[model samples]
Target: MERSFTVDVFKVVAAQLIVWHHFSAYGPMSEAMTLQWPQLIEWLYRYARLAVQVFLVVGGFLAAQSVMNKPMTHPVIHIFNRYLRLVPIYIFALSLISLVVAILRTDIHADWLPSAPTFSHFLAHALLVHDLFDIEALSSGAWYVAIDFQLFVVLVVLCNRLQPYGVRVLSLGVALLCVASMWWFNRIDELDIWAIYFFAAYGLGVLAAWAKRSAFDAAVFWITVLLAVGALWIEYRTRLSLALITAVWLTIKPKSRVHWTPMKRVVHRLANSAYVLFLTHFGVIVVFSALWNIGHFHDPVTAFALTGFAWGCAVGLGLFLHEKAEIPVHHWLSHQSKLMFLRLTN
Candidate 1:
């Protein structure tokens, strides 16, 4: 199936927003920045949480589409393929952090690491259940990965059992469940934020996949966008949960085709590297912040610039890893998956 340029563009923008969200955290910016730049960085950050929702939706749509089209008899092979895709890079990131801790003698939290490098933690991470149970942090930002994996598992089972109708029902059910869960768990400080956001956003994506071409009304689309913006503003003021629900609904419309020469190519590449970027960017920031003495750079301008540079380095490294390690590993895993499927079927 041909990939949607609209989704690709959204992915790229979302990844950039993720980077910016982290960068803003590192910078010495105030809440007034939101008031000053209502449209650009401020507003984006205010609603930036929506980007992850977009990703989850896209993931659900794609995963359901693939599974419905290609029903795997031995799903374990497919699961193993996913394991191979993520675990190596996760371990690499962990190793990098371990090295940093050893070298800097930083007062790092031991809870982040496994008590014993025993098969349990590795298996937990390999299965993407580490964060679900709060076992270990393979990478600081691995909660999303864990949530994605869990959603994929749930989606696969639902798709196989319910077929096409399963996709629609699951999508709607999860979306409602997401909202309900948020309402119920709003007071629970220890709830996993990634899981909640992923379920809601991914449900929307599944809904989009099952959406008929004629279902999209331009009038409704525009109105939804306006509502999303309005909801975001209200969210900022009242911290109401419905704001997120509105924003998720607005993102379901097909993206417009905006032509740009090198821009598309750049975004596609970034989208591919988004996983690596997410996993490794924190370490990059820590390293750069240490080197630049970000503490000394009290000026927000200097701090933001330095943070951008750090993110750039992280993106570059992620791109490098994607080209050199991730792509090759993915290819190998795909091949092995096919072989494993054949063996199992035979």
Candidate 2:
């Protein structure tokens, strides 16, 4: 089946928001704007984090849909292909960070990368099992990748028994379970143990996939969208719970299209770079901040401008890496995995 252009646009938008979230974390804007724009900027930061939830939902939906539609006979090969798809870019990003640390000789601590990545650490990261044993994030963004892997495993097990209607039921069940889990964890203060409540976001994605494949109803879709907007507003007014509910509903609804000439094309291209940009953009930001002493940008406007410039550089670097490194590596690893699977089976 052809990819959904609408979902593709949504994914790109979500990815940009993810970058914005990270920029807020690493940039001086948040600290600088605290006094002058406390409520507005802080609210923006919260909303930006919500964008990652959207990405997770889309990923789950697309992944479940792909597996359900194409039903892989060789599950091992499928698993291997998935791992291979992510590892090259991950390793490249890790290497880039290592180079940064070496060049700058900065004493700043990184939770993801150890003082020195030993053989075991390398193996653990390469195998994508770093998070299972409580390994810290080497890069601030790696937590999502670990969560994606875990979600994939969960989907694979569920997909084995999923039928047409089964998908819908399972998706809804997972979403509820996630909300319950989050509530329980929060009550106990164990929320930090799970590393950002990824399972919930992933469940929403699965729900989205089921919604898409089920009968398309215009009223149902609009209702879900309205509820999502309302939920987001409620989240802004009260707490974070409503946002998740609305996100689940939105995932299952088709997004409305807005016609724009050049901006749409630009968004599409940036969306393609979402993964690469997410992985590599941090290195760009770190380098720029170090060189410019961006921490000194005490004014919100100046800090925001510097953050934007840093983001642009990161996007440019990501684009270059996507064309030169990411795409080629993905092709090579995919082809190599196929060849190995054929050899092993034949």
Candidate 3:
């Protein structure tokens, strides 16, 4: 498949929004600056939650591309590959968060900042069951990582099962289940751990991809559009609205053809580093806030600049770790996965 510049751009923009959401929603810096620019902070805090929909939609779209026309040779191996890819960086983020939370909790106080991790909390995080077990999120937004994993596994099974039947039957069946989820399961916040709650958005992504394929019937796309509209008609869900819009955009996207050399390179870099940025950004925010407090940078101009600077640092740090830590772990895990898959197949 050709590299999709459109998807790359979306990832970079959405990742930036998520980063901005955290900076403006947490700690002393956001609180201090809220008074200075209430509207800006409010926009970041409120609207930025929609950025998550972008990821879910994109995830579903990509998942379809991977499994739509093919059988998952080893579904368990595929799921394990995703888990290994995320866990190393996630654990790194959690450790940093726990340390930062411990140090900052001494003097700093905010509802946004999490409390110290207990033994069960650490264990739950290590196992990626923090959300399911009601343990506090060590790093902000870390719950999304687990949720993303669960969504992927569910889609893989749904699409890959009954491979002898056909894509239409499998995809349509999955879509019906997803619609049921959107109307019922997702409304219950307590079911956050399970993929059923988020399957509607994720399924829209899968169906959109099927609709986008040149060889497939265009009706698939229309079906996806209707499901999204129906979800909104049943209930006014802001997240669902964002996911529907994003899924539509992904469905109707042009091929990845970059005309400008410089812009292409920058987009490529940011898109590749988006996941790393998401995992590592909260630590930078905490440290930045702690520094600002200790240094007593209370002036409006300086405080605003501090927030912006920390934002840049967070992206930079993620890029650095992507190269230094995540890439190595990803490559190693992928290699191990292939070998494992081969052994299983043989």
TM-scores for all predictions? 0.72, 0.76, 0.93
User: For candidate 2, which ten residues in a row score worst on lDDT?
Assistant: 105-114
Give Cα distance to truth, residue 85, candidate 1, Å.
3.2
lDDT over C-alpha atoms for residue 164 of model 2: 40
**Evaluation by lDDT, superior candidate among 1 and 3:** 3
Write the residue-wise lDDT of candidate 3 on 52-157 in tens digits.
Answer: 8888888887777877666686788778877887788888878887888788775565677887778888778767788887777888868898898888888777
The TM-score obtained by model 1 is 0.72
Candidate 1, 1-346: lDDT as tens digits = 5456666766677777777775544323322233344465665566665567566666766665566456555566556666677677777776675466454334323333323344676677666777666686645566787777767766665555555464345444544544443344333446654455445445445544554323442233333334434444544322333334433443455555556669777887888888888777766755655554434444555555666677679889889988898788778878877887789879
lDDT against the true structure, per candidate, is 0.58, 0.62, 0.81
Cα misplacement distance, residue 242 of candidate 3 (Å): 1.5
Deviation in angstroms for 268 in model 3?
Answer: 1.1
- 2 or 3: which has the higher lDDT? 3
Error of 3 at 170 (Å): 1.6
- lDDT agreement of model 2 with the native: 0.62
Which sequence of candidate numbers ranks them by lDDT, best first?
3, 2, 1
